[model samples]
Target chain A: MADEKIKSPKIQATEQMKQLITEYYIDAKTTKLPEGSHKPICWITSGGPVEFLIAADVIPIYPENHGAMCGAARIAPGLAEVAEKMGFSRDLCSYARADIGGALTESGAIPGGLPKPDFLLCCNNICGTVVKWYEELARIFDVPMFLFDTPFIHVEKPEHATEYVRQQCLELVKFLEERTGSGFSLERFAEVAMLSVEAVDLWKGVLATAESRPSPFTCFDAFIHMAPIVTLRGTQKVVDYYKLLKKEMEDRVAQGVGAVHDEKYRLIWDNIPIWYEMRNLGNLFAENRACLVADTYTTAWAVDIRIEDPLTSMADAYTKVYLNISIDIMLEQLVELMERYEADGLVMHSNRSCKPYSLGQYDLSRAVAERTGKPSLIIEADMTDSRVYSEAQTRERVEAFIESL
Target chain B: MPVAGVDIGSLTAKAVVLQGREVLSTSLTQTGHNSRVAGRRALDMALDRMGLDEGSLGFIVATGYGRTAADFAGERITEITCHARGANRTHPEARTVIDLGGQDSKAIAIDERGKVLDFVMNDKCSAGTGRFLEVMASALEVELDDLGSLSLESTSPASISSVCTVFAESEVVSRVAEGAPKVDIIAGIHQAIASRIYAMAARIPTNEALIITGGVARNIGVVRALEQKFDTRIVVPEMPQHMGALGAAIIAGEHHE
Candidate 1:
């Protein structure tokens, strides 16, 4: 297996990205609060308006990303079991279970477990689970929580909905000011929002490079590379990091270096990645000479944010993200992804953690296949929970899907 | 060239040897504790039946859940594709294949060339599979093979509403304790399994030439129940259990080319 990995080279960017994330996490954890100009830590949802936190000079931490780390480390089930033991339903979102468990047990992939949150930011743009999940956290930590209620976009985002979210953004800034004793800075906010947009555009450019025949990188690479973009979105480090990563991808494309050795087929992935099975899943496709060129999960960050009008644009962008929208729009997006990536098939992970992403995937699978004249495979598993995964069954389905293609 | 296909399923291992387009020999055996041993035993039995040795075989392909566990095969294909290929081989017009194995059930949609177009499988449930039938047979104190013919004798099929196998088993036991006829309860169990299978199969368009191929296909009651629910005449190939191995053999022959 070690030799196999050496033979199949991983993206050169992953090593650097890991160091960057490590440094970022260390800085967030070690930074002192209320002393020597230290920033407070704000536990934010994955799809929350983190730029506001960044603009307010508050260190933002994502429980979802931490849950994914625990998943990759194969400790999610232990954490989830902790939550289940506390009377939470096993059917509840695994990420929430893991997060709640990590908080309670004070055990996680990280050493100290997500730098004790000074406050909580709950956003429902990604899923409704976060609202309740964060409320529970607020109760446990006894901190002032800010909830950004982004209305679901069934078909279209109404102007009032945008105004509603925009006003909430303003309120969030005021909340941050009152809690941290730091006034909002428009100049710093604009700079952070611009950097965030630049990082997102760079991420988009990196993903688009996969449109080349024998894609330069796979979705697994994007899944890992997406870390800095998610956690440090509004920081200059994210922009610099993505610039360096984008250059590597461009070079690989120019050199005709595909992520898969032979690249016999190109496929698109749907829903959150099965975090525990990332390497196994990557190898499964790579072994079949089928490269997963793109996925709907990581591309959520690529939704171009308008820095000129950051408030309203952030509201619209976050509201219309891939998960918060209707099945019609989701299917359309899947169809477009298939065509754009020139995928031979689409592999949809019927993820158990993320219902907003997993629900309606079967219907979307058929719709995309009909549109692309290709095939689609739906594998049932949770994003973070490894116990729900049946390796033998999933292997059979994946191999069969590739064989059919 | 004599090519072989091996299907190492959860309960049984099957093998088929093909010389060109003609099936030279076939073998079936209990999978037992080790899939690798079962696979080797099945293949060796087929070879011995053909008055040949392993050296005579040109290529081999493995299918079923234990396909990866077997180290002997040159390639491993999925049972979904194998079933489709085997069904299409036996019945030239077969476009759909429903395979009911010990622990799982699947409905596969295939093209004219025997390539799988779409498929759906039961989600880690034994509610609508051969294992479910075996459990019901034991609960009714009936032989697995005889349960099907016995169910045909019932005039009124009892209602078994529980979709879960465990609950359905308890339902069957309770009905028996209540002095309900075994044949009616058996019929209901068959119908319950068929309903779940039909629901999963309905996910994709079940085009013409729907064929049922698996160990459970031998159970006439479940087959008839499924036929009744699908509202279509289902064809069961001769030696349905060997279809996956046969398909693997066919694929092996192609790979040898």
Candidate 2:
């Protein structure tokens, strides 16, 4: 007999969010045409300073987001193989491989691939791989590139490192002015930075709703809803979307609704999601009565961008991102999240494609357990590469972990 | 009322039948292509030994790689939990369990009541598992049962370095060609498995008294090597392969009430 699976009710805002993403992509794709918006398209890293581009009236494109799209669409492995055949090592980040392979093949989740970039923006705060990934893209498209270096924070963000990043923010402004053939506007940047802060605050508010018992949404929901926060952070559209998302979450919480049916355990997820397995993982957890109420990935965007001094605050906020900090600091943040979310346990993805995120996970797992007396399960798999994933093995581990909880 | 537990592993199927706290009978059989059939056969054999039939069982819990295939099971649980419960039952002092099964190996940390605290398993790799040793034994032209006793006779064990099963098999073949003693090669294979398991098992706290369970626990050479690596005496419960089935049976009894 086929078992009746108890699925979490679909969030009402998903269709609206999808439509918003479609419109964002359509707007980005049209900007490349001579008769279109005529706005210069800058391919930026997921952690790049997109607010500057917004202020400069240039359309920002995120290849990392596009890589995630391909992954969710289940076409990443095929695309990544193309790059592997082109002599790129399989050990390279799957995101880079998928994006590069999509560019060469002109096939992806989106037709005709992402519109060509007039310029490339690379940030090392996320990982060192993006530096080379963007360099390759710049060479391929024969475009100017901006490299923003954020030094790793061992204990705290040093004044010199912050100043160094702050100086780069200035140079980034000049770079934007030169590329767009327009003058830099501090007034415009200030307005964009304020909107960026407001959107991020709303995003945090949306995520915080998970603190309620029988959380309104899971981290899988957050991963989907986070698209606007990552892609269009400085715009009013992002602010409006998150406000709507937050309200829906509040209503769900007030109604005592949960993302998982009969939510028995609340888990905190660590690291980037396995994009291809998101739906399956979500269903598997929900079936076991575990709700992944929070995660470190989506909350990476929740960093406060103080608008008091736009450039300095941007420098500090971008430099001290979740990935760029020391393990000790990451642990503190993780422990805090566990307590705030009232998590029953933690699930960490030991992502093969991401070294910085995956490294020190074992230590962090041990530390978190010691601090919170909560068990942690580490699953080894690549974020975008399905080849590295073993379905039977992963299921067994997850089931066993849930049983332990 | 009698309760039963069926463990459908990749290589074997095991079943344990119990009434109250006492084990009535146990059975083991090779798991061929169809796991559901193997599960039923194992359970039936155990029941037949006790002169009881399927209807006699009050509850049936299933476990292992093919646990879900046993549709007759009242509950399906992972082999990790089963092994921990089984180990704790056999050796109540067991706080840590290293289960080396056919296709996978796992290190589990359990509480006083045998509830799992944390666990780590080999990631999609065949190294440090029973299958790895089976491949090496076949490559050495030695019987699987003789591998443990044969390795004990070697004074200087050959060094087999490859972690991949296929590569390690080739390494053993080359050692055989180079006139290395079969005993030494076999001993080296055990050492390699021990080292790989040690590296993974070290991630979790290895609180003694540590116990080894699963099909691989039947191999004395691997147990000795693990003892040397962990620097602790390891307990091997009687009928090590039946631990998961035994644990499932115990859980079945719990669920019956």
Best-matching candidate per DockQ: 2
TM-score of chain B as predicted in candidate 2: 0.98
lDDT of 1 by residue, B132-201 (tens): 9889989888899998899999999999999899999999988988888999999999999999999999
TM-score of the first chain alone, every candidate:
0.97, 0.97
The residue-by-residue lDDT of candidate 2 on A96-196, one tens digit each, is 99999998888888888998888988999999999999899988899999999999999978899989999999999999999988898999999999999
Q: Evaluate all candidate structures by whole-model CA lDDT and list the values in order.
A: 0.89, 0.92
In candidate 1 chain A, where is summed lDDT lowest over 10 consecutive residues?
Answer: A1-10
Q: What is the lDDT of candidate 2?
A: 0.92
> How well does candidate 1 score on lDDT at residue A137?
96
**Residues A1-405, model 1: lDDT tens digits:** 243642356677778899999998899888975757567889999988889999888889999999999999999999999999999998899999999999998889999687889899998989888989999999888998999998988878889999998899889888999988868998999999999999999999999999998788889888989999888998888899899999999999899988888788998998888999999888887877889999998998887678779888988888888878899988888889888988899888998888888888878877876787888889999988988888888888888888887
Model 2, C-alpha of A51: deviation from truth (Å): 0.4
